[model samples]
Target: MTQPSREAIQTLVTQCLQEILNQRGTELSAPLTADTPMFGTGGLLDSIGIVTMIVDVEQTIAAEFNATVSLADDRAMSQRNSPYRSISALTDYILGQLSEGA
Candidate 1:
C-alpha cells in the first residue's frame, strides 16, 4: 500500500482535532493552523483533551490509511521534540510511522 502524503496526514489531523473540539463544544480564539499548539504551554488542549485527540487521530489514520499506529508510544515520548507539540509535528510523526510500516 502506498503511504499517505504529509498534506493528507495533516488534513486528517486537523479534522480529528476539529471533531474533538466540536464534540466538547469548545471554540478557539483563532483558527487552527500548522503552528497551532496542541500541547504544552498556551496549548489548546489539556491532558485529557490531548489524549482524546491522539486516540481519535490514531483511529482515523487506521481507517483512512489502512495503517495502525500508536501515537503516544514510548518512541514518540522519547523523541527530542514531541509529536503532540503542534499539528504539523503530529502530522510529521504520523507520516513517519506510516512510512515505517510501509
Candidate 2:
C-alpha cells in the first residue's frame, strides 16, 4: 500500500483534532483548517486541550493506519518546538514518524 502525502497527513490531523475537541465539548470558534493552531498560543486550545488531542491522534493513527504513535512524551515536552503547535508542524511530525516506520 502507498503511504499518504503531506497534505493528507495535515487533513487527518485537523480531522482528529476537531473530532477530539468536539468530544471534549469544546466548539472551536473557527473551522480547523491547515493553519489552525492546536496550541493556545496561536489557536483556541490550551495545554490540557493539546493533551486530549494527543490521545485522540494516537488512537486515530492506530485504528486507521495500524500504527502506534506516542504523541505526548518527554520528546514533546522538552522540544523547543512542539508538534501540536500548528497543523503544519503536527503534519511534519507525523509524516516523519511514518517515514521512520513507526
Candidate 3:
C-alpha cells in the first residue's frame, strides 16, 4: 500500500485542529502550521484538549483512510521525541502508523 503524502496528512491534521477549535469556541494566537506546538505547557492544547484532539484524529483516520489506529498507545508514550509535540511530528507519526497498518 502507498503511504499518504505529507501534504495530505497535514491537511487532515489541520482539519482536526480546526474542528477542535470550533468545538471549544477558541481561536489560536497564530495560525496552525508545521511548527505549531500542539501539546505541553506552551502548546495550544491542555490535557483534556489533547485527549479530544487525539480522539478526533484517530476517528478521522478511520473514517477517511479506512484504517484503525491508536495514536495514544504505549508506543507513542515511549517515543524519545513525542509524536504529539508539533504539527509536523504528529503528521509524520500518523503517516508512519498508516504505513504500519497497511
Candidate 4:
C-alpha cells in the first residue's frame, strides 16, 4: 500500500485517541484534533497512556497500511522533539516511517 497522507494519518490518530479515551473512561471537553496535546503538562495522556496510544497507532497502521512500523521504538524515544508531543507531530512521524517503507 502507498504511504498514507498526513490528513489520513491524523484522522487515524484521532480515532485511536477517542478509542483510548472511551476505554479509559476519560471524557474530553472538546473534540480530538491535530493540536490536542498528548503528553507533558496539560496533555491528555500520561506516560502509560502515551504508550497505549503508540501501540494502538502502530497496530492500526499495520492493519490499515499493511506495513509494520514501531511508533515507540528507540528512534522515536531519542528524538529531540518527541513525535508523541501532539497529534500533528505523530502524524508527521508516521508519514515519514511509511515513506521509508515505500
Candidate 5:
C-alpha cells in the first residue's frame, strides 16, 4: 500500500474514537478532534475504554492498511509521551509504525 498522509491517519483515528464513543452511547459536548484528551485527566476514555479503542484501532488499521500493528506494546509504554494521550499523538505513532514497517 502507498504511504498514507498524516491527515489520513488522523481521520482514521478520529473515526475509530467516534465509533467507540457511539458504541458506549456517549454524546460529547464537543466533537472529537486532534486535541481531544484520550486517556489522561479530563479524557474521554477510562482503562476499559482505552483498551477497547486500542483493539478497535488495531483491527481497523489491519483491515484498512493490510498491516498488523500492536498499539499498546512495550515501546508504546516506554515512550516519554504516550501515544494514547490524544488523537494527534496516536495518529503520529501509527504513522511512524506504518513507516517503519514499510
Candidate 6:
C-alpha cells in the first residue's frame, strides 16, 4: 500500500474539524485559532466527539492512501505532544505516520 500524501492528510484534518463544527454549530465568539486546544480547556472536541474524529481520520487515510494508519498505537499515544491538540499538529502527525509506512 502507498503512503498518504501531505495534501490528503491536511484535507482529512480539515474535514474532520469542519464536520464537528457543523454538527455542534456553536456560536463561537471568535473563530478558533490554530493554537486553540482541541481536547482540553478551550478544546472543541468532547470525549465522544473525539472518537468520531478519530474514526473519520483513520478511515479517510486508509481509503485515500490505500494504507492503514493506527494513531492510537503505542508510539503515537506516548508522544510528548498530542496530535489531537490542533489541526497543524494532527497534520504533522499523520504525515509522520505516512512517512513511516513508506
The prediction achieving the highest lDDT against the true structure is: 5
- Residue-pair clash count for candidate 5: 0
TM-score pick, better of 1 and 2: 1
- TM-score of every candidate: 0.93, 0.80, 0.90, 0.92, 0.94, 0.81
Clashes of each: 0, 0, 0, 0, 0, 0
Task: Give the per-residue lDDT digits (tens) of candidate 4, residues 1-102.
Answer: 777778888999999988888999988898777988887778899889998999999999888889888887899999988898899999999988888878
Report residue 68 deviation for candidate 2 (angstroms).
1.6
lDDT for residue 87 in candidate 2, whole number 0-100: 82
lDDT on C-alpha atoms for all candidate structures? 0.89, 0.76, 0.86, 0.88, 0.90, 0.76
lDDT of 6 by residue, 4-96 (tens): 566667767877777887888845666665556666567888888777887888898777777777867887667778888887788888888
Each model's Cα RMSD: 1.0, 2.1, 1.4, 1.1, 1.0, 2.1
- Give per-residue CA lDDT, model 2, range 8-60, as digits (tens): 77777888777767777987677777777778576667777777778877788
The alpha-carbon lDDT assigned to residue 55 of candidate 5 equals 94
Off by over 4 Å in 3: none
* Model 2 lDDT-worst window of ten: 1-10
In the predicted model 6, the residue pairs found to clash are none
Which sections of candidate 2 miss by over 4 Å? 24-29
Q: Which of candidates 4 and 5 reaches a greater lDDT?
A: 5
lDDT of 1 by residue, 46-77 (tens): 89999999999988888887889988899988
Which residue pairs in candidate 4 collide?
A: none
lDDT of 3 by residue, 1-102 (tens): 566788988999888988887898887777788988888647888889889989999998788877888999999989988888888999999988888888
Q: If both were scored by TM-score, which would come out higher, candidate 3 or candidate 5?
A: 5
Residue 56 CA displacement from its true place in model 2, Å = 0.7
Scored by lDDT, model 3 comes in at 0.86
Clashes of 6: 0
